[model samples]
Target: MNDVYRIIVNHSQLISFWDFAEQPGQEAVAKGPFPYRLTEMAGPIERVEDGPFGAAAQVKLGQWWNLPRHACPELNFHGKDAKLTVLAWLKRENIPNRGCEAIAGIWNETEKKRQYCMFVNLNIWDSADQVCGHVSAVGGPTPGYKYCMTSAIGSTPIVKEEWHCVAFTYDGQYAKVYLDGVLDEREDFNPYLYDSGLFDGGDDGANFTVAAVHRSNEMGNFYTGAIGGLAVFKEALGEDELAELCKITV
Candidate 1:
């Protein structure tokens, strides 16, 4: 592991990572003192050249992957009083079909439920030209569930076909989103803890899929575009550090 990762993991909670640099025919590879490997599941999700971090993964035509949740509970942030940060490079090929489209998420294993999610909210009808999204979570008890809290970005039209760095962070109170290395949006949510419960997933966290959420696993809601790279930090990165990361290019 590098000195930077050691420092980041020191204070953060759950950090899922994928660089899409797996060697040909290899069983997926992840970074860290505790390595977590992922398996490519559905089709059309291929490896390609050029990415912010390195080799990139192409997600289009309903393709995605199943990631094994990283080992060590400290690396899992789907629970309460969590400090979560997700950073990734996105290149949208076109406006995905109307309605909510998920970028990635872990929902209740039983189905039709959610724990935490990061996604772009599109219109239901194909005519609306607005662009927006949210980073949401289902906190507290189940029946008495806190109804899902969200942090959204407004009128940003993030569906364009160009590489853009996106980052989302939730530190137990407010949800902040950064786009292209700049703070794009920020929303304050009712403070509470996230409960992973049955949806905490299993073994390397392979039970969950990427480019889409466990809830909308089936259908055309999966993201249709390219993911240059992805990383999760247990703790929200300092603005200066995050800005430095955004300076990296393909």
Candidate 2:
């Protein structure tokens, strides 16, 4: 068993780039006694290459910068009445005119439906631009009936070619989105949407992927950019914690 930290008074739960660098393996920090493990679809390091933004870096599952195509790479956690959070640094080099999704949650794939366990996607269908967030309880409500919440990230294009930190937190009923540590959006999901079924867990022959979803369109198949400093937590971080997480300096 890994060393688990208990929630105590004045306990500082903070993770930094230095912490990530120091830990060579994927299962670096075991925050609590929760039944979860942080697994890297790809390793911690990747390379940056020349792109639309002069020079750029890429991070993919397993080795970084390959763009996870399918539901193969993910961080798996198992427990009831649990909260979860995921954090990542993204630098978009090429924002496709077409639709694309930058995922940051649990993903489940089945023969019938492709569920983004939790996600924040850039919707670019029919010239409509939107930044939407969603979470799904696998096999719930006949599949694909998961709860979703969305808000416009920016009125204009958000392609400044700089790194940004995106974080997501869930308290079972509600989910919140954060940009560079600031609360961008919050959603209260309908329980009935998930009443039909619960997540099949990681054992239902389902796998999760990060950064991108499974399907692709003519517009683009992968996200062209540099991604780094991804982290996951088991509980919904409180307001103070959220504030601290937002302070990440990339």
Best by TM-score: 1
Query: Which segments of candidate 2 are over 4 A away from where they belong?
Result: 1-46, 49-74, 77-80, 109-118, 124-132, 140-159, 186-198, 216-221
Encode model 2's per-residue lDDT on 27-106: one tens digit a residue.
43323322233344445544454322222235433231222223222244333343556655666655544344554444
Give candidate 1's whole-model lDDT: 0.53
TM-score of each: 0.71, 0.57
| Superposed model 1: Cα runs more than 4 Å off | 1-16, 23-26, 68-75, 95-98, 108-113, 122-149, 186-207, 216-220
Clash count for candidate 2 is: 13
Which consecutive 10 residues in model 1 have the weakest lDDT in total?
189-198
Local distance difference test scores for all models: 0.53, 0.41
Number of clashes found in candidate 1: 13
Question: What TM-score does candidate 2 reach?
Answer: 0.57
